[model samples]
Target: MDLLKRRLDIAHVIAREFLGIQEKGEQNLLECWLQEDERHRMEYEEIRQLLVAGEEAWKELEDGDLVAAACWQELQREEKRRSQWWVVWYRYASIVVLMLAVGIYYFAKQESPETIIHVETAAVTPGGGKAQLTLADGRKMQLDDTIRLTFKEVGGTDVSLEVGVVKYSGVDTADRKGAYNTLTVPRGGEFALVLADGTRIWLNSESSLKYPVAFTGNERRVEMTGEVYFEVARNAAAPFVVEVRDMDVRVLGTCFNVTAYGANVVTTLVEGSVRLNRGEEHITLSPDQQGTWNGDKFEMREVDAQSAVLWKEGIFYFENDPLEVILETMARWYDVGVFYADPELKNMHFSVKIKRYENINKILGIIAQTNRVRFEIKDRVINVYE
Candidate 1:
């Protein structure tokens, strides 16, 4: 009995820390407890795994063994041990199972729901290579598996559409003026393009890029709205400039990514260097650095360039992002409207790594396991609740 009490005391401290109820300095006690015996560390690991296991697995564990009475008693005296009482303790079958249930209960209490909603659905299809091309004469053509477009020349530029990529070859266009082409990728779609300037670009969903059929001016300039990853061709004589949202990205030769969604513009540099100009304010960004223009001002931060450009590589890599932000990305990729049934659920944080091509429901199922929220899909809308 005495040993059981001491084990419960250690369990209480570990549980509190795991649940984020204890302060950082308080971790010393748990560390000392673990170092005192190898079995202590093993026991803690077991408890941790059980806590993160599925709800059904936990119920099965509870049925296998758990003494509710003893666990309830130890939970009551949890705080009393911080001020006094020292004893020897060991793990038993009942306490082991009971501790797992207690961890779940604590997590559940932390996310108490003001309202309850149940939801789940089949996997919605993923986005694919699709877009629309508008010619200089204002003629729109759809690019898909069925529609094959072969244009010999678009205002002195040779254009070829093959598979999912569009290539525009350079030609003497000094004789021509005011001729441009625009490529628009709608929701649940993406496309690739090689401009006449030799720059390669990958366009994300809900984005558009407008460029001249051939470079002719003092600078090779393109206007874009949406998201694009660029590998600008080296041309010191005529610097490549991309006008996106409220900012202009100027590059002599570089690889970078620009996301101009809603009212904000985020430019992430992958290689070489680029200058971001918004009115008179200009900032230079190095490799692995990102510049965010939030309407009024620019904020610079160092980020993992690969992670920022993962969308082009067919992956969704979210590094400790908030739920609302993740859902916003999902909305564009899956072509769905996201609504929070409970607005408060939007603030929850998630560090997730999932393939961009995965089914929508599969992604939601993984997130729902966090126990912080649930999701429902109706038609093309996703509703999140607690």
Candidate 2:
């Protein structure tokens, strides 16, 4: 088979069929992705469609100069469908991209069940600010009520939501071993807290923080279920440990941010050093560094803390926000449903500066304005027009 030609055709098919984008012809897809503004949607679409088409046509081709744009289709199409075990073992990158590329293998074979993990830090149902505080006495406090009230004294941690910050102080830990209290932050809202250790924490929307009323044992450990930023109070003897999904974040009382949302958990260290452990894979990061726990692996890179903590500042600082990504942010903050009238809108990306108080419609409009796209808002859903 003509490998180069076949690979190009597969790429074309991926861009057009899977992603629902027609480059009008096969050759145009390569050009489009290379010059398709900055969203990189064109590239992503090309990869998706090509993978789909190649799955059917791969194995028939002979060897050639495995071009950058055409290598994946060649290998995937040529190889006979392997068991999901092999596919998973073969996967060496983040799950987001690799999972889709090796679609057949991911769900094809039956093996020992992989651990069922929850990376979602936030969950918002019909009601906004849908969170609860489980008192040590087995009493539950619903947080939707905006009126601040003293909830209960749960295990020496007086859990109270006063002016949105869940205060957990009043009671002392009595210097016991590892006794802890938990706080759950549901979707559509955020909570701040001052730990008895003097570490101030900011829990973003749809997140929870479980920590001991006082640091006990050999370490100060906290379990996380979403995103949180910490200005940790230092104690070398009691290093801070954050456990999320399958990774462990150990720090010596440094300021940092942890964002493990849905299959994507990222740990950004702002000061001092942090050791990031993903299963058996371990890597240490310094200030201004980041480690992203992809589906199957960990990716470490440097980052600007400003972009990571922009949400805490009450503004949407989207350096490059795609439509759906932007919509997720809006859905959480504005407490609304997200819908797209056209598939093309999903292909667009924006770099706009927006505030929290802006209405949903206005936010959508501003986003559309950036892309020269128009939108319609009814009820809580947004309809985009090309």
Candidate 3:
């Protein structure tokens, strides 16, 4: 308990320092703590550098902005209630505090009219449950949260759309032997589905999945691009396979997330076991393990597998990810484009947890607080600068 308190106290001190509100006593305490261990000093330096980077970025914005002045005033009021603020005490506390401090400083320092900057952009809304369903006969039907109905596929398979999910059922297995359906989730949209075999799938934005209307053989396979989370129904006799560009993930029944948006194909296992195969090279993954097939070789690593599927839960959780990677994800979900003025800024790393449904500006504001980067939205493109 004392150890935990000490860590929390250190976080508070560091946060105050980042906000430029640390008292003399807190500064002395932090200095003493820094002298106690080399690791502590290193941690402090790393966070300080990040904060400094943010400060430098803020200098790029134009002055006398109305929005910056309003934000500065609001943040000043928040600072008075700093003691009541929630302190997230964990291994990542230092990094989290750095983000908080940079954000607070970014707003707080804009109090002077000469330092304020104004930005104008159209409101960008969040993505929702929407997708395009293509039947075996190539008929396309649009699906969204508002639509609810039951329809029959060309192969006489019963397909239903209710509560944003497209489900396949009641098909004569013999008649719909090779009939296939595809769910295409476009940028700024997401969708869910239940296969005839009872496997549940959640597709992320800019993703597509092609599956059979009915299971008629010894194996069930689905071809997919982009990202998808699956909860395969248990079927010992018939194995389930997810086919990516160059690899296949085989499983009897399991819950896992597959990300195939780029050159790399990543499979994060949440429950049960999965075997990944590429040509003759194959690897098995256990729960909480992630397998990445980067065209040639496959690499495995242990991770918080559940974190990989947070998109299904309406959250964006990034852990020590680069700015470019994070923005790429945001671009897909928000259906926007990104351009960075300083390419080096793309390498800035951050850890963030934010609601997926929040306005794009709110998300950008949080990152802007870090002072590491400022964003300008024109048309539907997000321009980033250091």
Work out the TM-score per prediction: 0.74, 0.62, 0.73
Best by TM-score: 1
Candidate 2 segments whose C-alpha is farther than 4 A from its true place: 1-131, 144-161, 170-179
| Candidate topping lDDT | 3
Model 1 lDDT per residue over 50-130, tens place: 655634434565466546555444644764664322211212333454663454455446443422333344446788889
Instruction: Say which prediction, candidate 2 or candidate 3, comes out ahead on lDDT.
Output: 3
> Candidate 1, which ten residues in sequence have the lowest lDDT sum?
84-93
Candidate 3: tens digits of C-alpha lDDT, residues 158-243: 88899879988886535766678899999999999999778999999999999988877799989999999999999999999999
How far residue 296's Cα lies from its native spot in candidate 3, in Å, is: 1.7
> What TM-score should be assigned to candidate 1?
0.74
> What is the clash tally of candidate 2?
11
Please give the range of 10 consecutive residues that has the lowest summed lDDT in model 3.
84-93
Name the 10 consecutive residues with the lowest summed lDDT in model 2.
110-119
Model 1 misplacement above 4 A: 1-88, 91-94, 97-123, 145-149
- Comparing 2 with 3 on TM-score, the higher-scoring candidate is 3
